[model samples]
Target chain A: MKILILGAGGMIGRKLTAALLRKGDLSGQAIQSMTLADVVKTDAPASAIPLHTVAADLSAPGVAAELIAERPDVVFHLAAIVSGEAEADFEKGYRINLDGTRELFEAVRRVHGADGYRPRVVFTSSVAVFGQPLPPVVPETQVLAPLSSYGTQKAIGELLLADYSRRGFMDGIGIRLPTIVIRPGQPNKAASGFFSGILREPLAGLPATLPVGDDVRHWFASPRRAVEFVLRAAEVDTSGLGVRRTLDMPGLSATVGEAIEALRRAAGDEAVALIRREPDPAVQRIIESWPEAFDPQRARALGFEADASFDEIIRRHLEDEAPATTVRS
Target chain B: MKILILGAGGMIGRKLTAALLRKGDLSGQAIQSMTLADVVKTDAPASAIPLHTVAADLSAPGVAAELIAERPDVVFHLAAIVSGEAEADFEKGYRINLDGTRELFEAVRRVHGADGYRPRVVFTSSVAVFGQPLPPVVPETQVLAPLSSYGTQKAIGELLLADYSRRGFMDGIGIRLPTIVIRPGQPNKAASGFFSGILREPLAGLPATLPVGDDVRHWFASPRRAVEFVLRAAEVDTSGLGVRRTLDMPGLSATVGEAIEALRRAAGDEAVALIRREPDPAVQRIIESWPEAFDPQRARALGFEADASFDEIIRRHLEDEAPATTVRS
Candidate 1:
């Protein structure tokens, strides 16, 4: 099987690329070739398969067509202007997130029309698609009322992906991933960044700020689980999806208190002491508008799994980031 | 108040224009000027105010900017490719419905940036935004899983409207109108056309085909009521809408049997007898996918009313189209 990964330079993208290379196969077919495209060329990982890394701005006029010309069997579209960036620069957000996604779909559609070349297109949506007035546990039937420009762009992409799939232009599946906890990277300015930072920093023997209250809850999955969800989406039988092509990925719903307890259990009280309670009301208010939990029945039924618990999430982060210092209680 | 109607040549657009002209005011402001734009130049109605009719394709570059250059106080965006046409031709549908709507919003945003020129944008969405696996009465929270390309485009437009409104670029309200019954025109090829044709043709003393079973239910409102919904959208207090700017306009839920019975009551059994039973399975299957009813709590609370009953709907058609031959109870 041939594969193309957009945003292959990002943390999850790089992880996914490595995972594919380690496996050297997808959906039981040997990985014959792979192309990784992003705004900046991704580092070429050592691989036996024919691999190409290209720098392409997807929103540029002819960029999508050029990237799609090779036509891989499975296309993993993970590129996006992050929420904070999208909210700050509205035009740039729409250009990269909305127009860029549409251009990619259009390119694939044009190819589909010429020779019925329908590839498995897996799109990465986000839980940000659900917003205020949300239920305590958001149901699968919850209407998409995105509170941010980034959320709106993702919701629109979901709609387009479904429409394109229904029209026989492509075999597509959209997975609305939860807030990925323990994101293995340096801290960022994202409001939800602390969800990862508090755990990631503490595990790495660094201090992290806790902006929201301990009782504050949010949906989550480890980065490893997120990668697994994408792979499942690529290989899952889509006949069951009908026209509603998007699925809310299964995620572990836990409170900040629960996450901290899990962290302390894994890395001892000393590690947990690294958390500084310096509340930022602005971040708290922004976080409050997000969904805390979801009853993602569809994704669960489709066999997509989440981290067993917050404990497992912390353990996985420790194992992935600091293997030598990893401690299990 | 200066007003602009994007699809002034369409049935609802023309009716809305005539209503605005007849009222001589909107939101208690005196009428000043009006601009009517469409792909074809709309017939200029006799008006005392400065009324300008121009032919413009909203999807075309520079067109939306030109239209918004004057910056009307209220803009009624009722333009779209009909569902049947959109389903048959995908590109044209997205171009006219999705891209055109976005362009208009972008134009407003640019103007709003320069001088804070935020106009009350009344966008006409449709119940087609809801599809199968639907509840008996689709509620305000019903997820928009549009089954057709036209519905998809309208749903996207709704998202853009809400996002733009939330950003303070424009004061926007989207009303999801029901299938308009007794549409005053020659029968078109729309799958939902029969919903109007059975009543419209018989009222005109012509035979009409009934392609579905009598029990096949659907949601509807009269064209007059649809116009009223648009007007209400234009004048209503949008502060209550928050970020979820769209409302499902209240509509009477009735079956084909109920409609035929209402026709009997309005124009007597003579009008009902003109109906012919010719079950076209293709049409039946298409109509079956439509929403049967909606629990539009938001629209109801906002004072957007529906026709009292199917009888009232039929009576209104008589009042509007055939006043000379109209018979009361």
Candidate 2:
């Protein structure tokens, strides 16, 4: 199966690409070729498998159609502006997030209209599609009431996905992802980055500022689990997914204190001591508004799994990524 | 006040236009002119008020901008393809309901961006935006799970309106109208038309066939009441609206048996006897999936009112529409 990954330079996109390349196949489906496209250049995976990378802005006119012309059987759409960036630049956010996604769907429709060629599309949505003043545990039946431009754009994308799928132009599944903990590399523009950054930096013996309180709770899944959810969504039997086109992926809900304890258990006192608590009101407001947990029965019933505890998530991150790290007793 | 009414040829549009003309002026605002446009030609009001009637297809490119360029202080957007028609033609539904509304909003936005011009836009949405398997009383917070293409398009339109309003480009409100009862006109394409037709035809001493069972329940508001909701939505204080853009208007919820009983009370048993019931599984499936009632607390708090009971609603129809009928003891 040939596959294309949009926004391939992003953290999750890069991890997903590497996983697919290293596995060399998906559920016995042979991986023939992979195309990675993003606004920034993407690093090619270290594999003998054929890899093609392209750096192009998708919001430009005709870019969507041009990208789909390659006719990949599977497409992973992960492109989006982060929450803070979207709020800061409203026009650019809508241009890239909403219009870009719609244009891509239109391109797929046009291709299928010309010839009955329907491709499987896996779109990575976010929990940000929800807003605050909500129930403690949001159910699938809860209406989408986004408070920011980023969330609004994601909700609109989900609507478009559902409509296109209902029309039978393309086989699509939108996975609403949780915050990926122990996110590797430099901190991005998302306000929620500190949730992962605090642990990642502390494990590296570097001090990290905690912008939220110890009691602040949030839902999380490791990067490995995120990739697994995406893959399972692509391979699952969609016959049961009625008109509600998107599914909320399963994740572990943990408080900041729990996260600290998990880090201590995984990497000992030295790593835990590298953390400093300094709350910023701006970040606090954002954190307080996010959902602490979700009852994702729909996605769970569909065969997606995640770590049961924050410690397991951190351990998995250390095992897959910084393997040289050991507990300093 | 110069007013522009899109879709002035339809049932509610005609009634609203006539009511506005009857007032001779809107509130304390003097009526300088009224422009009416639709996919087909609209009848000029018999009043002495200056009327400009245009018969142009709004879905055509550039038409929306052309219509908005007239600079009307009040714009009533009531245009849409019915549920059945929209389901039959997906492209046309998106073009007219979704894209057409956006074009008008964008045009107004450009006008506002150029100068400090903002107009009160009253968009008529529908209860169809809510899908089936709902609680007996759906709250305003219920997720907008639309079953039909038309409802999805309306939901999208509501999103766009809220975003545009938040940007300070236009002052807008979306009124989610319940199914209009005693809809005075020929039967059209809506699958739920029998909800109104079954009552209206029998009152006129004409034969009417109900495709669903007596237990089928639906939410309803009279045509006059629907117009009133639209007019009130325009003047209501929208500061508290936040991001919950659409307001579910207050309405009466009645089962088909209750509806028949109300008809008997208002027009006697003879009128009710003209009704024949034959179960249509196709329409029954549609009706069974619709929302039985809406907890329109938001709308009521904003001062929108509906008929006290189904009986009162039926009586109003008889008093206003079928006045010439003699009483049969």
Candidate 3:
């Protein structure tokens, strides 16, 4: 099976590529080729398999047509502007997040028109699609009432995915992932970046700021689990999805206080002391608006899973990021 | 009050224009100018108030900017391709329904940037935004799982409306209008057209076909109530709308049997006998996917009203549409 991954330069994208390379196959189909495309050249290890990388923006006219020419059996669309960036820059957000995704879907549909080239499309949506005035535990049936521009873009994406799939343009599945706690690498413009920073920085023996109160809770999953959701989404029989093609990914629900305890258990008091409280109401308000928990029964029925607890989430972060530092925290 | 009405050539648009002209004002402000735009030239009676008509398609590039140049205080966007048309033609659906609405919103936002030209944008959404498997009585919080291309486009429009309102680009209100039963005029391609045709044609001494069973129930509102909802939507204090700006407009729920009974009451047994039962599984499937009823508490709390019962709906239709063709059964 040939595969194409958009946003292949990002953290999750890189990990997904590596996992695909290691498996050498997907859904029992032998791996034949892989095409990685993004706005910038994505780094990948040299392999015997044909691995091609291209730097292109999907929103730019005709660029999507070139990528769709590869006829990859599965296409994983993960490219998007983060919440804070989209919220700040309206035009850019719509250009990239909304227009870009539609361009990709249209490109695939054109390919289908040529010779019935139907590919499995796995789109990465977000919990950001659900906003304030929410239930304690949101179900898969909750409205797509996003409060942020980034969220609105994703919600629009979900609608298009379902429509295109229903029309037989493509076999599409949208996975609304929870916030990825302990996200590796430098902090980006995402409002939820602090969710990872507090734990990641403390584990690395560096200072990090806590912007909200301990009681402010939210949903989360490890980057590894998120990547797995994308892969599993490709293998699932989507005929059962019916009209609603999107599914809410199951995630661990925990408060800041629970994360702190988890960090202390993993790295001891020294590492735990690195987190400092500096209540920024701006960040607090954003965090408070996010969904705290979800009853993702549909995803569970479809076999999607998550980390057992926040302690496991912290441990997975350390195992993935802190190999050479040897902080033990 | 200056009013700009898009899709002014349609049934609702003509009535809305007439209603505004009759009142000579809106929300206590005198009518200064009225700009009516549509794909075709609209016919309007010469009046003392300044009125301008333009032939324009909002999806066309530059047309939206031209319309926004007038900077009307309240813009009523009642334009859209009906459901069956959208389902048959995908590209045209997105171009007109999704892109056109976004283009109009973007133009308004740009005007706001130039001289703080904020307008109250009242959009007409549809109950098509909700699809099966539905709850017994859908609430405001129901998920937007639209089953058709038309519904998807409307759902996307609603999201954009809410986001634009939240960003302070424009004050927007989206009303999810119920099926305008006994819709005044010839039947269109909309699958729900049968809902009105069974009553409209028979009442006029013409035979009409009932495609679905009498047990099939759905929501309804008269054309008069629909126009009122749009007017009230503009006057309501939107400060309480918060995150969710779109609302489910209140409507009466009844089965085809009740509608027939209402027709019998209004026009006697002879009119009811004109109805021919032709069970069309195709249309039956379509009707089955639609929402049966809704607890539109949000719209109700905002003072939006609905027909008291199915009898009232039939009476209103008679009072407005069958005034000239007076047939007392």
Candidate 4:
């Protein structure tokens, strides 16, 4: 199977690439080649299969067409500006997230129209698609009333994916991924960054701030689980999806208190002590509008799994990021 | 008030233009000037107000900027290729419906950024934005799962309108109009044409084909009521809309049987007898996927109204189209 991964330099994208390399096959077919495209040229990972890395701006004319010319069997589209960056710069958000996605779809469509070359296009949507006035457990039927430009762009991408799939231009599946808990990286300034930072920083023996209250909750999954969701989407039977091509992936819903408790279980009370309560009302208000839980019946029925609990999420992060610390735990 | 009508040549656009001209005011402001733009030069209506007609394709570069250069106080954007045509011609549909709408919004945003020139943009969406497995009475929170390309384009437009409004670029209101019954024109090839044909052709003393079973239900409003909804949207207080700027306009829910029965009441058995039952499965399949009814509580609370019954729909058609025959009735 030939695979193409957009945004291949990002954390999840790099993880997904590594997972594919380790498996050596997808959907019962041997891996033959792979193409990794991003805004910057991705580092070439040691691989037996033929690999090509390209720096490309997808929104630029001919970039998508050039990438699609190789005719990969599966296309993993994960490129996007984060919510904070998108909200800060409106034009850049719509340009890259909206227009760039459309251009990729159009490129595939043109190829499909020519020779019936329909590849499975797995798109990464977000939980940001659901906004305020949400139910305790959001159903698959909940209306997409995104409160941010980033969410709107993703919602639009989902719509286009469904339409293109229905028109026989491509086989498309969109997975609305939950926020990745214990994201393997340095701390950033995202409003939801603290969701990961509080756990990630504590595990690394560094202090992290808790901006929201202990009772404040949000949906989450491990970075490893997210890669699994992407792999499942690539090979799953899409016949049942009908015209509604997007699915809300299964995720663990937990409060900040639950997460902190889990952190203590993994790395002891010392690690938990690293969490500092310094409430920032701006971040708290932003997090309040986010979805806390979801009744994602479709994704569950499709056999996509989530981290068993917040403890599992923390355990997996340690095993993946810090093996020496994992031995100590 | 200076007003701009994007689809001035189309049915609802012409009606809206005429209504604005007849009223001589909008939002209690005296009429000053009007611009009518379409693919073909809209025939200049006899008006005491300054009227300018331009043949313009909205999707074309520089066209939207030129249109927004004057910055009309209200913009009634009703231009779109109908569902059937959009379904047949994919590129044309997205080009005109989706890209055109975005270009117009971009034009408005640029102006708003420069001088805070935010206009009240009344965008005409459709119930086609909703599709099958629908609730008996779809509520305001129904997920937008459109079944056709035209519906997809309109849904995308709605998303852009909401996002743009939230950013303070424009004060936009999108109204999802129901299938217009007793449409005053020769029968066209639209799947929903039968909804109007059974009543329109018969009322004009001509035989009309009824392609679906009498029990097949759908949502509807008269063209007159559709015009009223636009007018209301233009002047209504949008503060209550929050970021969800679109409303499903109130419409009467009736079956083909109910419409035929109403025809009998309006123009006597002679008009009802002119209807022919030539069931076309293709048309039936298309109509079956459409929404049957909507609760539309948001539009109701906003004072947007629908025709009381199918009888009233026919009565209005006669009153507006054939005034001389209305006296006979």
Better of 1 and 3 by TM-score: 1
Clash pairs of candidate 3? Answer: A267-A329, B267-B329
TM-score (chain B only), all candidates: 0.98, 0.95, 0.97, 0.98
From the highest lDDT down, the ranking of the candidates is: 4, 1, 3, 2
Candidate 4 accuracy as TM-score:
0.99
lDDT of 3 at B260: 92
Task: Please provide, for model 3 over A1-329, each residue's C-alpha lDDT reduced to its tens digit, 9 standing for 90 to 100.
Answer: 98999999988889899889988999999999999888999776788889999998999999999999988899999998877789889989999999999999999999999999989999999888887689999977898899989999999999999999999999999999999988998866667888899888878778998889999999999998998998899899898898899999999999999989888888888877898999999989878888989998889999999889888998788777777454452
RMSD of each: 1.1, 2.3, 1.6, 1.1
- Tens-digit lDDT track of model 2 for B1-329: 88999999887788888878877666568788999999987779777889999886677888877888888888899998878788888888888888788789878987887887798899999887777559999988887768877888888888777777877888889999988887776766567888777788887888888999998888999877988898787678888888877899999988999999888877788989888888889989988888888898888999999888877777667766775463333
Candidate 1 residue pairs that clash: none
The whole-model lDDT of each prediction reads: 0.91, 0.84, 0.90, 0.92
- Each model's TM-score? 0.99, 0.94, 0.97, 0.99
Worst window of 10 by summed lDDT in candidate 1 chain B: B320-329
Best by DockQ: 3
TM-score of chain A of each: 0.98, 0.96, 0.97, 0.98
Backbone clash numbers for all candidates listed: 0, 2, 2, 0
- In model 4, where do residues sit more than 4 Å from their true spots? A326-329, B326-329
What DockQ was computed for model 4?
Answer: 0.81
TM-score of 3: 0.97
